[model samples]
Target: MRRSRLTVVGNAVALPLLLAVLWWVASADSESIYFPSLQKILGAFPETWLDDGWGSSIIVDGVPSVARLAIGFASAALIAVALGTAIGLHPRLRAFVEPILELVRAIPGPVLVPVVSLFAGIGDGMKVAVITLGALWPILLNTIDGVRGVDPVMTETARSYHLSRPRRLIALVLPAASPQIFAGMRQGLSVGIILMVISEMFAATNGLGFSVVQFQRNFALPEMWTGIIVLGTLGLLASLVLQFAETRVLRWYTGLRAADHES
Candidate 1:
């Protein structure tokens, strides 16, 4: 197990290092205005992003982007889980709700940003709404599936023992469904990040996405690249956070699976 863990870690580190080296070597002598060398891009990263100090550009730009993502992602997760649980408990409600879900799902998320902007306007609210709406579907569907997929035997046993609804939920349903719920949340995080940028790109005065677009229009290619790198880094960090949370939350599930595998 230790060896396997080490191998996973080593592979993760090695692939990125190899890719970075390849990028560095391949772009070392490139003179294209659109595609600057990796060295130039790296050189520009500090001044481009950090500017006068650590907080200058990041304060104006990065904070809002990250904030929007967090708020939107959290809002979506909570709402989805709650609604999903309710719907999963009622077959009639699910039948009605699913048609609406399918209709909305057919429309792409980016299109909703402009429509949402019309009502919410081009403010933080609008951006957050866009992110929330975009990230909502995956989580909602998965939570519903997870809740409904709880073992019938387990549920029947709980009912036979006269377990209250809340007790059953607390002791059984959520635990059984958590793996799927977490999977949905992971996907939702990615969607939220994408929508964060897309919403800002569409209409915003200050944000990482807006800043990157501004850099592009002004031909600040290196700065644009730096903005992208920052976005990628944020994504990596967010994923790591989710992974840690999942590992802790589902430690019992992991142990059970491991023991079964060993048997």
Candidate 2:
């Protein structure tokens, strides 16, 4: 157990450590106007993002971005899971809606940014809408697939016991389909982050994305790099949090898989 824990820790830190070393070495003496040294970017970070009292750029920019992402992703996940359950359990409904779902999914998410902006205007509403719509597809489709993939035997057993629809879904179907649902959620999360940035790029007063663009336009390369680094850090943290949640949520599934392998 100790060895396993150590391995996990090492795996988590190895890549970041290596990348930090590489970045430090490679950009140590960089003179290019476009590519500032990592040190310079790090130095600029405090000044640009952290120095202002309660109104620091990081708080102003990062907080709203994170809030929009949370609201959008949460709304998307809840709606997708509920709707997918309905569609997945009904063959006729699935067949009727499949084509339209595919067509809508085919339209690249970012392409909707301008249209959403036009209708919703550039506000929190537009940003959240863009993110929710963009990230909805993966979770929705994966949930449908997961629900459909549940074993027929399990469904029969639930029916034999006279389980209510909601009870069956909660106790049987959801547990069985959780892994796939989680996979979809992770994909949706990544998509949400990308859309969050993209949505803010066009008509936004404050956000990491807006700040990045502002820095670039002003030729503040180091500050721009800081924004990029912040985005990367946010993505990594979000992924780690999701992974931990998934492990907890699917612990029973994981235990069963392990038992099967042992047997």
Candidate 3:
């Protein structure tokens, strides 16, 4: 168990450690104007983000972007799960809307930036709207698939027990479909982050995206690198959080899978 725990820790840090070493070696003696040394970037981190204390530029710039991501993602997940459930339960509805969904999904999310900006203007509302529309498809489709994939036997059992509609959905359907729903949510989050950054790049005043662009245009290479690093860190942290949540929520599933494997 101790060895296994150590192995897990080693595996978790191995890639990051290697990348850090590589970055340090590659850029240690670099003189290029566009590509600052990793040390310089690290040095610039405090100056750019923490110079003004806790409520510094980083917090000011990052919070809105995070908030937008959270709100947009939450809205997408809720709407997608609800709508997907409805469509999954109704074959006619799924048949009627599947083609339309495919057509819309084919249009890349970033492409909607200009179109959404026109109607919503360059505001937080527009940013959130863009994120929502962009991220909605994955969750919606995944939820639909998840719901449809639920065991017919389990569903029939619920019906046989004369479970009320709400009780059946709550006690049986949602739990069965949760894994898929989470999978969709995970995909949506990555897409949402991308869209959030893209939305801010076009007409936004403040965000990590704006900061990165601003730094690049101003030739602040270290600050640009910092923003890029921060974005990567955010993505990593968000994914880890989602994974932790998934493990907790799907504990029973995990146990069942383990038992099956053991058997």
> What lDDT is reached at residue 95 by model 1?
94
Per-residue lDDT tens digits for candidate 3, residues 135-206, read 899999998998899899998999999999999899988899999999999989999999999998987788
Highest lDDT: which candidate? 2
Off by over 4 Å in 1: 1-13, 52-56
C-alpha local distance difference test of each model: 0.87, 0.90, 0.87
Please, what are the lDDT tens digits per residue for candidate 2 over residues 1-263?
A: 46754686578668987998899999999999799899988988888888852233878999999999999999999999999888998999999999999899889889989999999988999999999998899999999999999999989999999999999999999888889999999999999999999999998998888888888888888888989999998988788778778877988988899999999
Error of 2 at 181 (Å): 0.4
Candidate 3's C-alpha runs over 4 A off are 1-14, 52-56
Candidates in order, TM-scores: namely 0.93, 0.95, 0.93
Taking the tens digit of each residue's C-alpha lDDT, what string does model 1 give over 123-144?
A: 9999999989898888988999
Model 3's C-alpha root-mean-square deviation from the true structure amounts to 2.6
Name the best candidate (by TM-score): 2
lDDT-superior candidate, 2 or 3: 2
